[model samples]
Target: MPGWDDNSLGYHSDNGKFFCHLNMTGIAFESNNLIKKGAALYPCVGFSMLQKSGIGGSAEINFGHRMLKYESITNFDI
Candidate 1:
């Protein structure tokens, strides 16, 4: 298993129209599936962010039990 930590920052519009969230993940160690013992490992970091806005009518819509609609969804990774 790999140990990890996350730091997050977020903001939302006062009018409930727009929102964004950012996260930074830090890995404590390296892991490999094929090599179990005496394997080389290194620590690393990652980042992600999401931004969404209301369009047409609202940011989201729901129908019955399973249907859903998102105005916009954007994701980033590094």
Candidate 2:
């Protein structure tokens, strides 16, 4: 989620890849201690750009969904 390479001149010659992601989550009937049951809706988006030697650069975007567990209301990744 962080970058160390300098691209101030708009030139990125890295041989690896650059990645990013965004997520939004909604929950209802959830308590502060996460001891109550709740319904949740989450939408996640991700993007990546790859630059390889003599291969140029490519970019991609992806979307996915996550369901909330009734047994575990404290988990955000699920």
Candidate 3:
């Protein structure tokens, strides 16, 4: 994970009805998976886009947060 202690820059664009949220997440944590951590901010109107690029696969993701996670599998028998 990298560091976010430095000055960060971000933006969110809108074309009348839709929006795209941009973020530069340089904050690093003491964990192997950086995606598992972040600072949640205010919720706004319309659609949004948040991108995070680093050393990790992108398929492991959830569409939205929830109170309880419904997993198809947790452990393998073999």
Candidate 4:
């Protein structure tokens, strides 16, 4: 749980919810979640697997050097 600890925040991709420290029941913010001023944030990714037979998952990372399929957000101020 990314936002279970202090100074941590996370956005749940499946349910479109946003979580902030100790907030287990996150709020619905979707893609418009904003960061507080002066908050130092970093980019990260995580994955998990369920305890079940024949369950599997994979992740692919792109560092922006290749052509993206969709238009990227370009209005970020910082």
Please name the candidate that would achieve the greatest lDDT relative to the true structure: 4
TM-score, model 1 to reference: 0.20
Q: Write the per-residue lDDT of candidate 4 for residues 1-78, one digit (tens) a residue.
A: 554456555555677775544323432232224543443445666555677765757767676688877763444633
User: Which model scores highest in TM-score?
Assistant: 4
What local distance difference test score does each model get? 0.34, 0.35, 0.36, 0.52
RMSD of each: 16.3, 13.0, 15.0, 9.4
Model 3 alpha-carbon drift over 4 Å, by segment: 6-29, 32-67
Candidate 2 lDDT tens digits, 1-78: 113334211212356764322224433332223344335423332224455544443444343355433443434656
C-alpha RMSD of candidate 4: 9.4
After TM-score superposition, what is the CA distance of residue 38 in candidate 1 from its true location, in Å? 4.2
Off by over 4 Å in 2: 1-38, 53-78
Error of 1 at 30 (Å): 5.2
Candidate 2 global lDDT: 0.35
| lDDT per residue as tens, model 1, 1-55 | 1223333222333367753222234222222342333323343333333346432
Q: How accurate is candidate 1 locally (lDDT)?
A: 0.34
**TM-score-superior candidate, 1 or 4:** 4
Better of 2 and 4 by TM-score: 4
Worst 10 residues of 2 by lDDT: 1-10
